[model samples]
Each structure stands twice: as structure tokens, then as C-alpha cells.
Target: MQKLLASCIFFMLLAFGSCTQESDTPILVSTEDLLFVGGDKVRISGRLLTNQDVLATDHGFLFSTESSFAGAQTLSLGQKNGPGRFIGESTGFKIGQTYFAKAFAEINGQRIEGDVVELKTLTPSVSSFTPTYASAGNEMVIQGKNFPQGTKVFFGTQEAQVLQNLFESKLTIRIPVAAGQVVVPVKLVIQDKEIVLPQPFEYQAGKYTKVSEFPAQARIYDNTFFTNSSGFHVGLGRLRLSDSYRSFQRFDPTNGTWTEINFPGNPRRFAFASSSYLGGGALEVDRDVFQFDRSFYKINGSSFERLPDLPFNTREAMAVDWNGKLFLFGGRDGAGSVVREYDAIGRTWSQKRPAPFDMSGTTAVFKYGERIYVLAASGQVWEYLPSQDSWLTRGTYPGNTGQGFPFAQVIGKKAYLGLYRRTQEIWELDLETGVWKSKNQIIGLPQSINAGHFQSNGMIYILRSAEESTNGVLPMELYKFEPDAI
Candidate 1:
């Protein structure tokens, strides 16, 4: 009985030992986890399980677009001698696509594979872009996710230069030249997928043409400018402290020519001149001492009819014509905020309400509707109601005033202001809504000052003179501004 019992126990122990030996796999592979996933690449972590050190001729991962592993791509890890965790990476995968992956190992010419795992590549998308408005050659950045290699950007039909792409995201590109269009849609093409950005990009749309050189060949500064039925006229400014240019020149937009016109009144500098009236200036200079001129006149088609001389004298005063009356505001010589009115019927000058701040001929003032909008050097936009003779702060000027002396020309209901001394910036102000928008900067001569400006038929004509520091280096030029042009 004892022998029979011992035989049964021995058989049972042998069976248990056989089961343990069969359970010890020589080389086993497991698809542990996906370490990372990207637009076109993925890193997979895999494990090789074995009871003892087993030589694996090859170990790696398999990736394929099909679940059946047909036409699968292999990421071989060469060879392995021990059982442990292994990692492999596969690239050149399609973005926003689903793929199947599995870990595998080869031992003794036999193949071992783990369970297949499914993953989807990240989709490429754009979030936003900076600087909706830019000029050609300006750098702009696009923020997004999963921007694959060989991504293309376009501004309308023009292809932009790609500067840099970071982390398969965030693209920096150079703005392309505008193809005679002010605003254009921005688009991106990635891997045959086209994307149009929500907001369209605007190109700097100002075209500057040197219409003609100043025929006077003399740099004019602090001059008087006016426009009438005939044309635009500019004159009456000092070439130096003791020398002044009294020659008035007329520019005809119809023929694109300039003609020197005659003024019967004595020549003077720092005078106030509007459409039909001219008065008050510093005239004769004796050893650098100025004598103010108070003679007034009414201009009528190349002829001047003398009117009553001004009651007081001031230099560089702002003048405008409204309701058949000549209105002047501010000047040098302690007349900073004074407002004076001369009625054509009465032929007499009367003092009106004072301006809100100091104003001069250099201050940018334009007539829109029934109000005179004054742009102060301090970036304040003052609205003056000519009817009520009252003033109110409308809004703030956004552009740089620089050394002051910016020009304001109104065409229709829009006012174009800027080109302040030593600055090339120009801004457009909506007289009706009081909203300001930045326009394209002037083409050249940033260190230039405005000599005179007048508008005709929705186009603004400007005369540019060099600043004092840049005198003689930059020629006095006439520019025709198509405010709404591309």
C-alpha cells in the first residue's frame, strides 16, 4: 500500500514540473503602450518576456494602415540578448489617419507577435495669426497645431516665403507682395488639404508717385496753402530768417502742371489763407526783426481785391471758410486759442469763442459736415462746432505726431492725417464715425515735413519739404495720394 501511494505522488509531481516548464516562454513580445503620437511619427513601447536570457535575432514594431497587417512597415531594433522593455519609432505616417501597430520578435527563425493596438495620428489645424494688416516683406506668425513639413502659405494668389516652422506647429512666414489688391485671403495648404483662415489679410495699399518736383526749386516750410475753383495754391513762406518766397504757385490737376500766379497784395510769411480770403502775417524783416502784415484781400480768379485790413496781427494762424465767413483760430504771439470770424457781408472781423487748446497753422484742422476737427500735437482730436462756437474732445489720435505739423485733408467724409515731421505714418479718420484706421506709410523720405496739402475729386495732393535737419538732402516733392487705392 505504501509503494502504491508513493508512485501516485511521484507521477503527480512529474506532471506539475512538466506544466511549469511549458509555462516558461523562451521569447514573448507584448505591445505595452504607445509612448508618443505626432502628426507623422509615433513612438511605441514594447516588452520582451522570457524566463531566461534568450537571443533574439531581431526585435521591433510593425505599423500598417490595415488591421490585417497587410503591407505593414517594420521598425527593426536589430538584435536583443535579454528580456526587457524595448522602444521603437516609426515615421512618415499620414496625418489624421488611423493605423495599427504591434510589437514582434524573431527567435531561432520563428516569429512572435503581440496583440495589435490602434491609434490615430494628430490632425493639423490653425488657431490664429498675428497682424491682420502687413506690408510685403514683413514677418508674420501663425499659431496652430501639427503643422507638418512642407506646409505652404499664400496671400491671395501670391505665395509667401516660409521663414520657420517650430515643433510641427507655429509657422513664421514673410508676407508676399500684394498683387494689386488691398485685401486678400490667407490660405494654407498642408498635405493636399487646403485651409482658408477666417480673417483676411490686408496689404499696405498706398501708391506714391512723384508727380513733379517743386518748380520753385526752393524748399518751402510754414507756408500757406488753399484750393479753389481754379486749382491748389501754395506760397508765402520764409526761405530763411530774413528771406521769404512771395511767389504763389498753382497746381492744375487737369493738366498736371504748375504755374506761378500773381498776387497784388504784398508778399508775406505765416499768413492765413483759405479759399477766398488771405490776411495777417509777419511781413518785412529788418535785421531779423519781423514786421507783421495786417493787409487783407479777397481772391477772385487770378485777381485780388483788397478788403479791410485785419483788426489785429497774428502769424501762423489756422484759417477756414464756412457759411460765407472767414474763420481763423490760434497763432503764434500769444494768440494760441483765439478764434476770430469775418463775415463776408459785414466786412468786419469779430472775436468768437476760444478753442479748447492752443492751435496754429501747423495743427491739423479739417472741415467735415458742420464741424472743424482739430488734431492737436498732444494726440487729442478736438471737434469745434462752428455754428455754436463750442469745442469738445472727440477722440484720441492713434498715430505718432512726431515733431508736429501734420496735414489733415478731407475728401468726402474721410480725413487723411499724418506725415508729421520725421514720420512716414498716415492715418485715416472717419469724420462721420470718428473711427481711425492706419493706412500705408509714405513711400520715402521719412524725415520730411508737409509743406501744403489739398484734396480734389477724392484724391489728396500733398507737397513735401525736407525737415530742417534733412534740408537739401531730400528734394521738395509733390505726391498724389489715392487714399483708397491698392
Candidate 2:
């Protein structure tokens, strides 16, 4: 009996040892992916069981340049739950974008990946809005809300003169003063359809209320945002990769306009191999190098040049700047990974705390004083301490919105993000507290495939596919999200 038991134990140990490997090949989890929406943080949960000490990629977004909040995409491992269940959250999603996720698990140096999951990005806001003080019809300058530039606002039965627009959401105009209560119902006309605001205002007072006294049709949430999608003060907002193609634009909420910038030669600038060039001022400036090269690079306006690269090749990794050194995970594509380092000034790569899993496309956002948040593709979320390059998996992407926001671009102390494949929408993740609170969604372009490259300079642009289906052909016209006031 003792001999038989020993044989069984030996077999079990061998089996578990063989399963602990890493893999870069994608998993095929269905595309019913999770979707994160609203200004509230959501959750995603799952399960995993393995007798091996395996590490692998789970979920995250890639195509860095396309994401308005593009940072590092992520990879994740399942957490222990209910003997089998695991959970996660897509904490830093950008609005108006779509995304897909996957998972991998390994035991004893043998790795296996999960399937892919896909989901659509949601509109920045559910409705368009306008604020006016004019009574029924005369003519009122209806300050637009939740509006993309070029959006038309109406004053009841009469079309108000759109004198000027500030930010895609703010507008100024004179009500026709047709002669009534000086108050009126405002509506937004889009696609030839009329949407009356739920809240009404009175122009009688001869003043406009931007946030308060909004009509029923006004978009309720109004988180401030700037061009960077990270508005602690500059209106930094949740940055969403508006298009799959390369393009840059900014929406000025102060003046409704969609400003455009020349496309960058480095379209996928957010790749793990490219993290070194985030600039010396960035929060994750790696002091130590990884697998790429010892030199790093930077995004100078709209170009890329030779800089330091990590000594090792990495994928779906997380990063942070500590004592001027970039502490990072040398995640494996699938062959079990390591945690490498890079020196910015010295221009060299070194070693540090290795990651718990082989990861890629993970997001690094911070709550400033509290901690730096790390999210992964496999729905793994954790906080990293620069003092110790270690990780503690918090949870999974909130909800099954496979289309969760994956970028976390900071503006001052605030962090903003954009969801994949979404037309116009952003989410704000406060870095001071590690909690998520969303604001108003932007109304930019319509959701389409490969929409990571869409950028806005106060003016949002949407290009219809000229090669989609038979009757789906549309012109690649530049539709100004919201033109600026002149």
C-alpha cells in the first residue's frame, strides 16, 4: 500500500510541474466580452483551477497609440475564489472604443492560453444636451451639452443662431427674443431627429446656467476634461482611441472645435517595447531596462527617434518610475517571463522583482498618494510599490463589457482613459484614492472596426469605411466634432 501511494504522489507532482509554463499564443475565449459603462466602476469575474504554479497573460488592450489613454496594455492571472472562481475589472476603460481580452495559464513551465473575448465601446454620453434661457421660439443661443462640434441646437420651434461653440460641450448664442416668457424648451437636432432636453431653463433672467438649471435633455454627468484626457485642471479626460487609423485631434470644451494634428509615424507608440521613450518627466520612466534595448525614446510632438531600449524583449508588461529607475516586469510571450530593469540616464537594462505571471498589455494608472494601479489583459488588477517591484492582484475587469477602457493618461493628478472601439466616451480614474468616478462622455465619432487611431484637437472626426460591404460604402469626409467659436 505504501509503495502504491508513493507512485501516485510522484505522478501528481510530475503532472503539476509540467503545467507551469508560459505561452504567447492567444486563447480563444468567446467574444461576448465584458463592457464597462457609466461613471461608476464595474466588475468582471471568472474561475480557474490548476495543480501547477503557472503564470500567463489574461486580458488587456494593445495598439497603444490608438488609445487616448494609452499606456501599457496588460496581462493577468486568475485569483483564488470559491475553490474555482476568479474575478477582475476593466478599471481604466476609455469611452467610445471597443476591445478584446484573453487568458493564459501554465503549470510546471508548460503554458496554455485562453480564448479571445470581444466587446464594443459605448458612446461618451447617452444623449446630447443644450442649455438655454430663452422662452419658446424667438431665438436663443442654446449652449450645447454632450455635443460633438458641428452639432446643431434648436430653441423649441425655432432654430437658434449658433453664434459660437466652446469645447464640444459648451456653446454661446442669442435667443431670437421672439417675445415670450424669455424661457423655452431646448432640443438637439442630429441625424435629422429631435431630442428634447429633460430639464428646461428660463432666459428671462438674462443669464445662462452651464451646469445647473439644465434642461431635461441635458447630459447629467459633467466631469471636466482637457486635450489630454486627463483633466485635474487642464480638462484632462478619459482618452479613447477614436479610430483604428492614425490621427490626432483635441476637443476644447471651452470652445467647441475639433482640432487635428498630423498623424505620428509611431502609430503604435504604446507597445511594451516602446515604453522607454515616455519622456524623463513621465511617471513610469524606467531607471532599469528590460529586453528591448538599453536606450529609450520619446514622443516629440509627432515623431520618434533613437532612444534607450530595454536589454530584454517584453510583452504585456507593467511599469513604474522609482528613484529615477524604471521598474518593470519582463513578462514572457509564453515561455515563463522575468522582471527586468532599465536605467534612463545610464542607458542600460538590469534586473528587478520578476512578475508573478507572464504578462502583456497591462495598464499602469495611479491614485497618486495612495498607490499606482496595474491592470492586465487577463483581468488582473494590482497596486505596485516603487520601493518593492511587487504586485498584489486586486480583482478582474468590472462587468463583462469586454469593451472596457484600457488606457490611463494623466493630466496633473487626475487620470483618464478611453474604451476601445467606442465613438465618443471617456472614464476618469482618480489617482489620489484608487477609486473610479466617471464624468460626462464625449460625443466624437461612431464606433467602427480598427478605430484606434482616431484623435481629436477639440474637434472629433469620424471616417466611414469606404470598403465596408456593398451598400455600406461611405466617403472619408472629415466631420468636425465641434468647430471652435470665432
Candidate 3:
């Protein structure tokens, strides 16, 4: 019985040893994972396993377009010692194409391969483009990943000029011509596949129509303009030195014509005016001789009803109306820092808090909602709460406030500002957010100065006069500006 048991144990041990020999390998290679994939490159992670320490004569990876490893390209790592994890990288692959890869190890004289892995190179993609609004020849940047060579970009049907491509990612391009369209879609084509950008690109949109020339054929400077349901009125300014014009005219949009309106006041210049009130300008007593006019008046239809003269001899003051009261800010001739309030209902004037800076004819002021904004010469925008009679710095103006005299016209929630004297640049300010965006420069003489600006029916009308040093007679052209028109 003992001898038979021994013989059985020996047979069992022999069988076990044979099974182990059939299953075990000296050096086993496995394709573990794909580290990374790019438009033309890939990184492969692999591992070598062994029951005992072993040396491989050569090891690395094999890549092929076929799954059967036919006509494969070899990436030989030469030799490796022991069993562990290894990584290999390869490039020069076609983008958006599928390829097969596997890890390999040469043991003794025989080559062994791991499991095959399927990899597809990434295609080009677009995440975003900057300067949502741009004009022809403007530089725009596109940000994304896996951008391959020979990638084409299009703005609508027009192809944009690609300036630079950095690291197969960011693309800098020059905007194409507008192609007579205001807004266009951006598209990218890579490897015969097209991708439309998420957001449509808008060409700089602003339409300026020459409505008419100043009716008098003379440029008015230091003028006061106001708008009401009656019409757009212009009065109280000098057509030339010492020759102030008291000829108030109204431009009727319905008739598209200008007609004379009666204003019972002395010939004045540098007056403060608003939709509701007009007052406090310098009266031209003689040639180049002036005296501060303390006269004040309230508008009723096409005429002005006289009111008691202002206590202060204010001229060129920034006047705005809010909550049925007129708030007069710093004036160049009178107190340059005092804030005066007038109640139209009570027919009384009272003094309020002082302004932060000196005000003049060129100070840009506008009202939106319950607040009033003043653009200072320093490019800083200050806000004033009429109810609280307090002031706070809002933000900085981005455009050049060249020589001040920047004019603003509010339509809805947006205020279009920045036609600073001699500059054609215009910017749109969102009164709700205090954010600003640039619009197309006015298509007019940059040497001209903005004499007055007013809005009607969501459209802005700009009056530009020639500079004092201009040689030819430049007409005070009236331009109808459509801020959002293409």
C-alpha cells in the first residue's frame, strides 16, 4: 500500500510540473493602455511580465494601418532588462485616421507581441473665437485643440487668412472682407470634414446716412440742442466769432426738413440745455464782447416760456433731468463745482452737493434710469444718484477722449458715447452692466468736432462742425446713425 501511494504522488507532481512549463513564459509583453493621442502623435503604455528576472534583447512597439499587423512599422527600443512597465511614443501619423498598435519583446531569438490596440488620431476642433465683432483686416484668435496642418477657416463663404498656428492649438487669423453682409458664420475644414464654430462672428455694424447739411450752410459751435415730441431743436450758438445765432430751428423727421422755431431769448452761446429747460449762457453784447445771460426758460410746445433768471451766472454747464427735477452740474463760467437743482413743479431752485470735477462744454454727460453718468477728461466715468445726490466712480472709458467734448445718446439700455472732438471713434455702453463695446468709427471727417447729439425713435442724429482751423467751409453735416445696422 505504501509503494502504490508513493508512485501516485510522483505522477501527480510530474503532471503539475508539465502544466506549469506549458503556461509560464520567460518574458511576457502586454499592451496595457494608450497614454495619449494627438493629431499626428500617440503615446503607448505597455508592461513586461516574468516569473523571474529576465533580459530582453529588444523591445518596443509595432504600428500598422491594418489589424493583422501586415506591413507594420517597427519602433525598436533596442534592449531591456528585467520585467516592468514601459512607455513609447511615435509621431508622423495621419490625422483623423485609424491605426493598430501593439507592444513587442524579443526573447532569445524569437519575437513575441502583446494584444493589439486600436487608436484613432484626433481631428481638428474649434472651441471659441475672440473679438465677436470685427471689421475687415482685423486680427482674430481661435482657441481649441488638435488642429492639423492644411486646416482651412472661413467667414461665411469668404476664406480668412490664417496668420499663425501655435502648437496645433491656437490659430490667429485675419478677418476677411465683409462680403456685403453684417454678420457671418465661422467654419473650419480639416481632413475633408467641416466644423462650424459655436458662435457666429459679427462684422462691425454701424450705418451712417447723410441725412442733410446744416440748413443755414454755416457751422454752429458751442451750440445747445434739445429733443422733444415737437421735433429736434437746435439754438443758442455762434455761427462765427461774436455772431451768436438765436435762430432756433427744428428738424422734423416726418417731413425730413428743417423749419424755424420761435424762441424768445437774446442771442446766446455756451448755454446749458435739456429736453425740458434752457438757461444760463453768455449773451453776445457786441463783437467778441459777452456778458453772462442769467435768463432761464421752460419749453412748452415749440416756444419757451420765460422764468426768473438764475441766481448764478452759469455757462456751459452739464444739465440733466431726473425724476421731474433738473440737476445742473459744474459750469465753466460760474461755479465749476456746484450742483444746483430746479423743481419744475414747485418753480424753485435749490443748491445741492458739489461735483467731483470741474465741468465745461466738453464734459460728456447722459442720463439712464435714475442715475446720471459723467465722463471726465481723465477717461474715468463717474455715476451720480440724483435721489441720494451722491457720486461714485464707475469705470474707465476705453476710447480716446481726445480734447474732451464727448457726446452720448441713450437708446433703451445702451448709451452710445465717444465722438470726442476730432475723433470718429464710438463706443456702446450698457447702462445696466456698465460694460462697454466698441463700434465702427464714424465714416466722416475725423478733423470735425461733435457739436450736438440727440436720439429719436431709437436712432441717433449727430451734428458735426468743422474745426476752427479748417481751411474750406465744412458743413455741419447731420448724420443719421444706426448703431446696430450692418
Per-model tally of clashing residue pairs = 0, 178, 0
Model 2 / residue 293 / CA error / Å: 8.9
Give stretches of model 2 more than 4 Å off.
1-270, 273-309, 315-323, 327-332, 335-338, 362-371, 378-380, 393-405, 411-414, 417-427, 432-435, 438-486
Report the lDDT of model 1 for residue 34: 86
lDDT of 1 by residue, 1-486 (tens): 322443355456556556787544344577878888988889988877665668889999999999999999999999999878899988888889999999899988999987788999998889989889767889999999888778899999999999999987799999998888888999998776788999999886666777877774777766788889899888877663337777788889889898998777677888888898888888655655778899998988556799888889889898888878888989988999999988899788899998878998658778877888888877788998988989999888798878778888888888888877778888888887887888888875777778888888878888888776664545678999887687
lDDT of 3 by residue, 142-184 (tens): 9999986667899999999889889889999999988777778
Query: Model 3: which ten-residue window has the lowest total lDDT?
Result: 1-10
> Per-prediction RMSD in angstroms?
6.7, 34.4, 9.0
- Candidates 1 and 2, the one with greater lDDT: 1
lDDT per residue for candidate 2 within 374-408, as digits (tens), equals 55544456666655656676554442223432444
Q: Is candidate 1 or candidate 3 better by TM-score?
A: 1
Q: Against the true structure, what is each candidate's TM-score?
A: 0.88, 0.34, 0.76
- Model 3 misplaced stretches (Cα beyond 4 Å): 1-94, 100-119, 126-129, 179-185, 198-202, 284-289
Candidate 2 achieves a global lDDT of: 0.39
Instruction: Tell me how far the alpha carbon of residue 58 in candidate 3 is from the true structure, in angstroms, after superposition.
Output: 26
lDDT score, candidate 3, position 439: 84
